[model samples]
Target: MFKKILIANRGEIACRVAATARRMAIQTVAVYSDADTHANHVRACDEAIHLGGSAPKDSYLRWEKILEAAKATGAQAIHPGYGFLSENEEFARACADAGLVFIGPPPSAIQAMGLKAESKQLMEKAGVPLVPGYHGSEQGPQLLQREADRIGYPVLIKASAGGGGKGMRAVDKAEDFAAALASCQREAINSFGDDAVLIEKYVQRPRHIEIQVFGDTHGNYVYLFERDCSVQRRHQKVLEEAPAPGMSETMRQQMGEAAVAAARAVKYVGAGTVEFIVEQREGGDMNFFFMEMNTRLQVEHPVTEAITGLDLVEWQLRVAAGEPLPAKQSELQIHGHAIEARICAENPDNGFLPATGTLAVYRKPLAHTSFQRSHLRIDDGVREGGQISPFYDSMIAKLIVHGATRAEALARLDAALAQMHIVGMATNVQFLRGVLRTESFSQAKLDTALIERERAVLFNQEPLGLPLAVAAAVAHTVLQEAEGAGRDPFDRRDGWRALGAAVRPFAFDFHGETHAAQLRYLHDGALYLQVGEVAGPLVIGRLPDGETEVEFNGRRHTLRVDELGGTAYIFGTQGATRITAIDRLAHAGDTQAEGGRLTAPMPGKVVSFAVKAGDKVSRGQALAVMEAMKMEHTIAAPADGTVEELLYVPGDQVAEGAELLRLAA
Candidate 1:
């Protein structure tokens, strides 16, 4: 094995690679941008080097800088962890030219699979089953529209150089094909710098299943079973599992053989994944078509590791060192069922838009830290006070669980999500739990549209009831009194009513609605609350671990309350809610702008303006596109009106809620 290696990436994947390298007694070097100077990955390695700016093009994507850092640190090889330069064929070749080993597939393999248009041709020539579509080299808009019409309506416009659901759009009719193609091509150019695209027939009831394949310099190969990545949102996998539900031995073997053949055709080396779009049919028949091959380690590789009992990164290191395949196809075996949920800092209720902020309070489930339970694991590269900046991916961590059966794994995953607590920003933890508890998921009836199919229950947001709201106010007051009293019990004057019952009024805002309540402190150490025609006496007790227990209407409930920046965040079994204290006496006028203004939802750079000033638009029409957190968000018109002003141009970075345009009423 190489003595020292450089990890040319950031975030959790970089930390993950460092863990494995350290176990192999190999020193690791980490490269970071200005945004990630104090990042977790930098702390995981023995040495670190500074890259450039926070944007990927200025830092992680700078292959020359990465090579310089590697050479300066005396690293013999470089591991491109998943994103950024992982699939850049030119970067791989540059590493080779610098006399440093690239711990991934050969540059030839990356080049062959990097472009979907050409890869489809290669797969077809290799006898791999392919979907019916247009994979030709013609890049004309008219030619692409003609092909889309030929493939019938509901065709998919996909960027030839896209992954992670970027630069792809589904058109349902001929009239929408032109706009969809333009948007797809624009995103393609912005993301991959390639405007070429391919049109394919959209498969109904499609299930995404990919086979993990590995190869060595000695020309040996093996398939590490498969992962079912069918549960997706916006064409990106949210939850993944190994040993796909209802998979038969015969189908597994056939898919495995096909995957190996595709890899051998390119003379693949190191780790790669062969993705397939499997179409479910009546009876038990399924037909799978080759989608694309990822020429590096995958984000969902942990699920593969849990089932196969192999460290894929370690395998990458060994193979890059010219070692033979660790095990033959017949020697590998699937152990137990495993599932992984990608925990992202995103708001599921608001179209899953990525969120950026400082993590005032971050805590993972305690179950993941028990060494006795080897089945539960968490892979993260963030700390409690880290910031989720807009310059990188929004994925905060991945929670993986294993069990003897799929049912057990599902149960464990749900429990773990419930135990997680994150403050200062929204996350998808509750959304993930809702998916795990869905009837379709429990029965393993999964597909790419599962989330959309279960949208009603998945997006349901229950109101923060009066009970919880009252509990939050009381908890806040109790904690404040305790802190002010210091260590002396005599100084604790909570509920003291020597001058008769005292009434304290509290104002709070929850979910855009303001509420007020009055708390009466009785001389007998009791409290009573009255709010909007509801009057009740409540009992509050503090637990040893700082949790609050509230008794109301003869029922007792325990909740965790975190007060930060004058906002009391209460977390219960139902979910979490933020209650900000309002000062009614010193209140100011509302700062919200009128509804006719179109504002940026988050901090991002303007990618394009579909409509300019004086252009008439209808409600729900796309007005502009903003790119943030590596994803594009479309800003639409609120009402049918003429655009009066365009405030910002393309490539201008704007803050959240910055007015981008105004529509004439």
Candidate 2:
């Protein structure tokens, strides 16, 4: 085995690779950008090297800088942990030329499967099943449009060189083909530096199932079953599971053999994934078409690990060090069912726009213990006080659970999602929980449009009722009192009322609305609170473990309170309620009108502008597109007006809430 390996990536994958390397007694080196100077991945490695700027193009994608860092650190191999330069054939060749092993597929294999257009051609020669569409080399718009017409009205225009839903568009009609193609091409060129694209017939009721295939230098190959990634949004996976829900033993073997054949076709070595777009029919028959092959490890590989009891990274290291495959195909067997939910720092209610901020109150649920046997796990590279920067992917963590059966695994996942607590920024935790509880997901009736079909309930934001709001206020007050209890007895005052002058007035803000309440200490030591039309007398009982128990109206409720700065985050069975204590006196004259100003919803760089200064646009018209967290968000006009000023041009990096433009009102 190699003595040291350099991880040419960051975030959870980097930490994950380091963990396996360390377990195998291989020292790990981590490379970080400016934004990740103090990142968790950096701390997890044996040695750390500084890359360049925070942006990927300035740092992680800089092959020279990464190679230099690896050489300087005396790393025997460089592991591209999925993203940055993982599938770059040039990088793999450069590593080989520099006398350093690239812990992935050979350069020829990567080149063979790197481009969608070329890979389809190769798959066709290999006799792999493929969807009927256009994979020709013609890059003309008109030629592509003609091909789309030949295929059907509904066709998919995808970037030939990138993954992760970047530069992908699904057109439902011929009229929308041009705009979709242009947008897709723009994103393609911007993301992958290639404007070439491929058109394919859109599969109806498609389910994304991928096979995990591994090959060694000794001409040995094996398949680690499969993962069902059907639950997706915007062409990206949300949740994944091993041993696809409706997969039969025969179908599994068929797909597994085909995937292995595709691997052998490319003379593939190391870890690779062959993704398929499985079309489900009403007659219960399934037809799978080859989508594309990912030349590196997949983001959802943990699900495969959970079910197969294998460390894929360890296999990669062994293969890269001139070792044969760990096990043959016959030896590998699916142990149990496993599921993984990707927790992202994105707002589900806001078009799933990526969010960036400090993790003020981040707490994960307990892992599975020997006594508990819960089989719950959390894979993350973020800490409680860490910052979710805008320069990288928005995925905060992945929650994986395993059980003897699929039903049990789903149940454990639902409970685990509920136990997670994250504040300071919007996340998809609640949204994921909603999906898990949905009837369709619970019954395994999954499709690519599952989230869209259940949009109403998935994006519904339950109102923070008065009871929860009041509980937050009371919890905050109780915590303050407890802190003061250790001080002088004379300073420990608990809402003392002298002459009934409205004891203490407290203001709180929830979801941008302010509310006021009055609290007083009753003669019997019970606290009385009047919120709006409701008046109740409550007793706050302190528990030994710092939990607060509220007794009101013959009902007792236990609450978990985490106070960060001035915001009080209260957790209960319903969910988490974050309320900020408002200072009425300090904000008496802070009423500002928000009109005629177009502000950024999040931090990102301006990708394009639909309207320039002095241009007349209607309400809800697309004004600009911002790229953040590797996703694009369209900013629209709030009201019909003339564009008076365009504050920032394309390519400018704007902070969250930064004003992009203003209209003449």
Candidate 3:
């Protein structure tokens, strides 16, 4: 191994790479932008370097700055962890020119698979299965429309240069093809600096399964099975798992072989993933088509690690050091089923809009070392009190669980998600939990459109459990007393109120609703309370584990509490939130009808505005589009009404909750 290596990335993946490097006794250097000066990856490294501004262009994407940092730190190699400069062929070549080893695939391999248009041609040349579409060099709109028509309706217009759902559009009809092409190209140019796009046949009920491939300079190669990445939103994967559910041995072998062939065609080196779009066939075997090859370590690599006993990062180091493949194809085996649920700071009920805030309460379940016993593995970059800035990806953590089978893995994932406590930001945790329990997912009947199809049922936030409410009531009372009295008033003899006939009435707010609770001291460190319309008294006790136990009307209820910065979190079936008890009269002006108006969900530059004042529009009509965190969101009319005002224009930067437009009801 080298004396020192630079991690050309940030967040969890950088920390993940450093961990394996540490075990290998290899010194690691971390590079950070202004936004991540105190990031977790920086703390994990043996040495760290600042890379200037917070914006990606000013730092992470600047090849010269990263190269200079690597040279200055005396790093002999660079590990591009999946994004930013990971798949940039020019960057890989620049590292080679700088006499530093690139810890991923060779520059040639990256060049071969970097562009979608070129990769499809290479796959077709290599005899790999491909979907029928246009990968031509023509850029004219009429020519592209012709190709889309030839490919059939529901074609996917995807940018040839980037991933992560940017510059990707799915057109369902010929009439929408022109506008979709323009939008895709515009996003493509802005995101990847490449307007070139490719048209592909959109597979109905598509299942994204990718094979993990490892290669060495000695021409030796092997496969680490496959991961099912069908759970997605906006064409980006939200959850992934190894040993794809309902996968047969024959199909696995075939896909694995094709993936290896695609890699070998480019003389690939190091770790890469060959993603295939599998179409479920009725009464027959599924037809798998080559999508593209990711020329670096994947974001969902932990799932692959969970099923196999090998450390992918360690293997990357070994291979980059000119070692042969660790194991042959026949020697590798899948031990158990593993599933990874990406816990992003997004609101599933609100069109999955990304949210950023301080992590007031972040707690992960216990993680296990091996796959032999069913266990949970949490890979995260942020801790409690950390901030999720608007400058980077909204993903906070990834919760992975392993079990003997897919069913067991799903069950563990569901349980782990239920136990997770996160506040001070909107999260898709509850949404993920609902997805795990959905009948379709439970049955392994997954598809790319599952989220869009079952969103209504999955995101329904109706109050379902009474125990949760009781627990919230109890926590609210305890926190209020703690704040007012400067300590737990139910501490010693002072807690006893036997000499008086007085009770304390406290008000609490949660989920836009209010409740009243009256508390009085009881023996044995218990507090008695009555909340809302409940007829009987409630007893609240704190357990040794710091969990709050509630007994309402003789019925015992258990709940987990996470307190941070005066925000109390009561975790149960009612879901998670930052709960604060306040006097209704004091903060009466805080409420607003912001969600009812067409506003920018996040701070971003307005890309386009389609409607003006007095424009009659129906619900869900696109009124404007805003780009934030590198993702474009179409702001639409909430209800059928006339546009009363247009408050924004193209090229305007608006803050979250800033009204961009208004519709008269």
Candidate 1 residue-wise lDDT, 1-665, digit = tens: 89999999999999999999988899999999999999999999999999999999999999999999999999999999998999999999999999999999999999999999999999998888999999999889999999999999789899999999999998999999988898898899999999899999999999999999999999999999999999998788899999899999999998998999999999999999999999999996899999999999999988899888788898999999999988999999998899999999898999998889999889777644221225888989999999999899999999999898999999888888877889978899888988987888989998898999999888946535765766666766776686688676668757665678888888887777888888888877678877777777877878898788877655677778888876887777766666788877667676666677888888889998998789999989999999998788999887899999999999999998899999997
Give the C-alpha lDDT of model 2. Answer: 0.88
TM-score for each predicted model, relative to the true structure: 0.96, 0.95, 0.91
Window of ten residues with lowest summed lDDT in model 2: 368-377
Off by over 4 Å in 1: 367-373, 486-495, 531-535, 588-595
Summing lDDT over every window of 10 consecutive residues in candidate 3, give the lowest-scoring window: 462-471
Candidate 3 lDDT by residue in tens digits, 1-665 = 78899999988888888888887888999998988888899999999999889888888898899999999989999999978999998999999999999998888898889899899999999989999899988889999998899889999999999788899999999999998998899899889999999999999988999999999999998889999999999888988998898899999999999999999999999999999999998974699999999998888888888888788888898999999988888898998899999999988878788998888778778776442334797878888888888778889988899888888898889888877888888898988887887777888888899887777778756433433464555555565455456355565332456564446666666666766667665544455566665545555667777677777766776777665554466676445544556666777797765444676788778998888887889888888888877788888777899888878779887788788877787
In the predicted model 1, the residue pairs found to clash are none
Query: What ranking of all candidate models by lDDT puts the best one first?
Result: 1, 2, 3
What is the TM-score (0 to 1) of candidate 3? 0.91
lDDT of 3 at 606: 93
Using lDDT as the measure, which candidate wins?
Answer: 1
RMSD value for candidate 3: 3.2
